[model samples]
Target: MDLKLVILFLFPVVIGSLGNLSLLCHSVFLYCSGHRSRSIDVIVRHLTVANTLFLLSRGIPQIMAAFGKQDFLNNVGCKLVFYLQVTAKGVSVSTTCMLSVFQAITISPRSCGWAELKLKAAKHIGRSVIMFWVLHMLLNIRVPIIVSDKRNNTNIMNIIDFQYCSVMISSKEKTTTFVALTLSHDILCLKLMIWSSSSMIFILYRHKKRTQHIHHSSISSRASPETRASQSILILVCTFVSFYALSSLMYVWFSLYIKAAWWLVKTSALTNAGFPTVSPFILMTREQFVCESTRKK
Candidate 1:
């Protein structure tokens, strides 16, 4: 129950939870206001929910362990918490990737092939969200068998501790299978996000050239709305990639290193929470910009 660890978990837990709650509230309000719902409105709702779950699952146990609660979670608790944490994290990545792709399609040229995607994408949001959850849940279904409260368990051949819960990798083969599955999940989502970001940037560049050619000058005395929207999505996607990559690198380093570094685990956990902690504010910025523009009108 180190005071430092308590303080570490508290910042992300308290601040991230509040920010995500606000974002969720704002999203729900917009949806129920009787006006047409934007694709982003739906995406934000799902994203915020996943972020909140991730923060809670990852944060609360650390906080409890910091408070000197030994064996605070039983075997069942470990399984449930670990399962929720990973599943929610997977959903967050997938949803953010979807957001970037949706934005790219939203801003793409009407005559371009992306236009057809726009028509189909909106209709599939609900189904996509369901698929993400189901896929991750099924993929990680082995979590329950592998995770247990350390105090209640006798076997400790290869245990990965998370302060309150421990994961027992029974054999090298199962470990390899688990790592492969998780890596595949993350790589696919990240690739889509990178592709979408590149497409958006290309589209924005072409737009800038068009405007400049028309005016024969440096365009944008003020940036266009489409430009502004694209910037927001770019920021969100880039931020997620930066934080997620750093956290993942730490994970890989830990796995490869011989001696266990509990400090490194704590650092990785904090870095892992970075996107969920920062994303709500990033999403809020777009609304602030939109509000300012509307008032100017």
Candidate 2:
């Protein structure tokens, strides 16, 4: 591979892996040190694991391919890598939506409907996490069945084509069905995230106004940890939406013109890796635990 392509593929791997690993380690340290863990911490820890897996599964193979290491992965290898990548992506999306909803519930007033969910939500966090994994795994089972290494195929013809992996769809009907299902799933998750984030923002705005009217000068004092965390969650949601939109547009273009230019594919891959690469740093900046841990060390 050329220097540019190598850097393009490897940068996300290094940054994302290191950042997420650090988050995971810090979360573990907090748990071991008897720092009472919040629900957000549990979700963030899971998010870090999913992001780390995403970086490894999605970034490494692309980097290897960029370096002209075509034969490094075989049919089974492609299946596993793509399967894990898709599954991790699904987990990431679902977990983010859950985080948004959880935060909204956390910050909602006692008289609100969201407040009613708080106790039930807290109790089901573990089960919900497990369900996210299981549901994504089941949904993406077709990935392994359809994906195969593209290294040895010289005269391949297909409805959909990829460089490192080929997805074999036998019929247009099946292709449409798969695409529709995937799109529907993504749309549902995105809608939930947007709704939850917007609700949180509105709630925060109302609270700020109410506080200002009540205390006139205690506005700064009203900025609780929950408020800070909500802002961070909003930033995270916006970041994910921006990157997801760009990557999805590229994907649509690729689908329409399967023989898209090489640079377009690289850009798509980079954008696909963008969220996982940057999300940990956003959390690190917003969360106090990371800073406190650094100070202690």
Candidate 3:
């Protein structure tokens, strides 16, 4: 076993699990305590869930395999684990997009039509979250079908051989169709996230310009809670996009080049898991999250 690789994976698993768990508990505590959570908070709660699952689904198996445990996942385990990991990632992508879009709407000018849309959007957040889960789960229902236990990790014919959980992806037609659909979903998510982020940036810029005549201290006080929240979400979105792009490139490289080296495969897995490991800290920095956490203690 490579001690470095083991530590590398283990560190993120421990840190990410704790961070996500803290946020998850915090979100639940707010709702349970009858503290009204906004649409963005609700979305952040769900994003936390998906991130936790992504970490667990990938982390445990990788850790087991790193300890020289091979073929630990049976056929059923492989199918379930593989499907859940990918679906968790899909839900994460869609949820982040939703968060950004709503933040944009939240910060939009009151004169714009977004006023009504914002009200309705909050009302339908539950439906939207359900829709994201259903969409990703339905879209990847066949993921388990293509996944099975692999007898060997060095198979050039396999698309993904994770030592324990291997995916055959043997059907060319199915592979192409799945790839096309996934790309379509990701593209739409990316476009919406970028649009919303850009809109938020523009709005912030305009607000700053309008407040330029004010004293520096006044300007510091001028940053509203919404502005600060928007900025945090913007940072979260940027982190997600960076990891998402890296993971996508690695995915494409693996798809095109089947005989990828073992180090590259591990790198791809780490890249794919990056956002889940990093995002909760970005979110926990929210003024409300921190304040509430302090109050609870």
Candidate 4:
């Protein structure tokens, strides 16, 4: 096994796993402490939970592979890992988009006529989360059908043949179908992300500018809880976009330019494998838990 690939896989797994745990612990602490949790907190908790599951699914198998241990996984293991990995990743992206949309409305001005609208919208947070899960489940049901744990007898043995589960793109016919569906999904996700981010940026820029103009010194006094929450969601939105863009680029490259190379598999795996690890730091940096009890010294 390549040491570099092993490192790339494990680094994100270890760090992301811990980060998600921390976020979950802190979120629970705040909720228990009666902080009157907002919609963003719920979103953060959901994102953290999904990211944690994603790390577990992707990380454990990579570790086993590095050690040349096939007994650690089987067909069932492959399917379980693939299912969690896909579902968690899709949920994470959807939640980030939801968070951005939630923030844009939360911070909208009263006179701009969106303040009342915000109250009526996203009122049912539970329903929103359920919708995300249901949609992701529907999107990823193809995993069981497409992924298989079959081996090849060729002298140039594929390392992933031992245990891998992904959308099979073997034949040209299948490739066309996969590419068309993937592009349609990507465009829809990208459109939603862009729309949400743009809305938040517009509302936030106006809010910040108006506050600055009113009292330059007061602007520095302190940020409200809502501002901090919005900032955290924005950071997540940016990170989510960056990861999605990188993954999409790799997908295009593998589909178009480098389909023959073993490196394509490695690259695709690595692209997806980074998000579980990178996301937690963004949340930590946003200091979302500062108001909670666990972080207080």
lDDT of candidate 1 over 1-297, digit per residue (tens): 589989999999889989999988887786688645776667778899999999999999988988999587888888999999989998899899999988888888897566778878988988888898899899889888878998855657567777788876567687789889999988998999999999999999998777765753434456776578679889999999899879888978766764457888788889989999999998888777665655566
Q: In model 3, which regions exceed 4 Å deviation?
A: 152-156, 219-222, 287-297
Q: Clash pairs of candidate 1?
A: none
Task: Output the better candidate (2/4) by TM-score.
Answer: 2
Q: Taking the tens digit of each residue's C-alpha lDDT, what string does model 4 give over 122-225?
A: 57766887788887888777676555454322233222342343234456786687567656766776687778778777877777776776665645566655
Instruction: Give the C-alpha miss distance for residue 104 in model 2, angstroms.
Output: 0.8
Worst 10 residues of 2 by lDDT: 288-297
- What tens-digit string does per-residue lDDT give for candidate 2 at 1-297? 766787988999999999999988988998899877776778888889999999899888778777877678889988999898999988998888888888888878887665668888998998888899999899888888767777645565653445677766456687678778888988998998989888898999998877776654555564755577678888989999999899889968866664667778678778889999999988886577334444546
The TM-score of candidate 3 is: 0.92
- Give the better candidate number (1 or 2) by TM-score: 1
* Model 2 local distance difference test score: 0.81
Runs of candidate 2 with Cα error greater than 4 angstroms are 159-162, 214-222, 289-297
C-alpha RMSD of candidate 2 = 3.1
Off by over 4 Å in 4: 111-113, 151-167, 170-182, 215-225, 256-260, 287-297
All candidates' lDDT scores?
0.85, 0.81, 0.84, 0.70
Q: TM-scores across all candidates?
A: 0.92, 0.90, 0.92, 0.83
Lowest summed-lDDT stretch of 10 residues in model 1? 213-222
